[model samples]
Target: MKVIGINGSARKGWNTQSLVMKALDGAASMGAETELINLYSEPLKGCLECFACKRKGNKTGGICAIRDNMRPILEKAHEADAVIVGSPNFFGYPSAMTRAFIERFLYPLSSYMMKDGQHVRLLGDRVIPAGMIFTMNADPKSYEMMNYQATLGATTANLQYVLGYAEQYNSYMTLQFKDYSAMNANMFDGDQRVYRHETQFPIDERKCFEMGRRLVAKAKELNQ
Candidate 1:
């Protein structure tokens, strides 16, 4: 079994990447060969909206027709038994890199054919388990206040519609700095935020690892 983890964070060794790595480690422990891809290192562009994938006589076979660095990564995702995608929430949604990658990855595999007067997916009936990890500086309560839940819910629904099943894990109130004094301290309740980071971050990491293991287990079960 093979599982692939993709990190959409621009920073190396940051919260999102660390969580994705832990998930990959969990999958590896389950006897699944796992690989991690950092999008910061790749030159990925958003979908061109050329509709080439929807055109007749297209030869790409459900793969994005774009010629870019993300093509190979998308191919890997298409072939992998499972995929773990991580992105830091930006402006109530995924970062630009993550959103672009997902658009390019999913658009090609989708179809606009009408079935019973409703559009239907033309992608193959393959079931690929996927997990999404979202990291943010706000707490769960603040997430709803920021209206991030709607964005996350839509993204998860799209993934489940295209891929057979999808799950999400969120890490809230992430620590952005080692020293709160380094940034604008007046804007935040530094004491409470720092305390949560010091106390809860480790628990969130454990949850990421377990999510990875569970993702692989479900993939294995489905593949069997």
Candidate 2:
């Protein structure tokens, strides 16, 4: 079984990447081969709306018509038994690269036709378990106040609709910088942020690890 993790954060070895790597480690522990793809490593674009995939008898099959840096990455995702996408929540949503990746990855696989009250998926009956991870500086209360669940849930809903099964994991109050004092952002208490990172980040890591393990287990059950 193969599971892939896509890190949409530009900063490698940071909170988003750390959690994704932990998840990949968990999948590896469950006897699945795993790979990590960093979206920031290459330039990519969102869907171009060419509709080539929607064209009758299209030669591209279910893949997007765009032949760019994301073509191979999309192919890997299509073949993956499970996929985990991680990003640092920017403003009220995921990073720009994460959103672009989602568009390029899902738009081709989604169809306009509906049957039995559900849109037909290009993958047909294939169930590829998927997961999303978000790291944010906002606390839980701010997250709720912003109605993040509604907006973020919609993204996961689309993933579930296209990919069969999708889940989300969130890490709040994430450390944004190694030396907070070095930056000019004075809205937060640097000491408290550091303390939170030292105390709570490990717990988040463990939670993501379980998320990866559970996703792999679900993929096994579905593919069995």
lDDT for each of the candidates? Answer: 0.85, 0.90
* Model 2 misplaced regions, further than 4 Å: none
lDDT, candidate 1, 49-168, per-residue tens: 999998888887778888889888989998988899999988888888888888988888777777898657555556788889999988888888878879976777778888878989
TM-score winner: 2
Error of 1 at 101 (Å): 0.6
Off by over 4 Å in 1: 115-123
| TM-score for each predicted model, relative to the true structure | 0.93, 0.97
Compute the lDDT of residue 28 as modeled in candidate 1: 89
- How many clashes in each structure? 0, 0
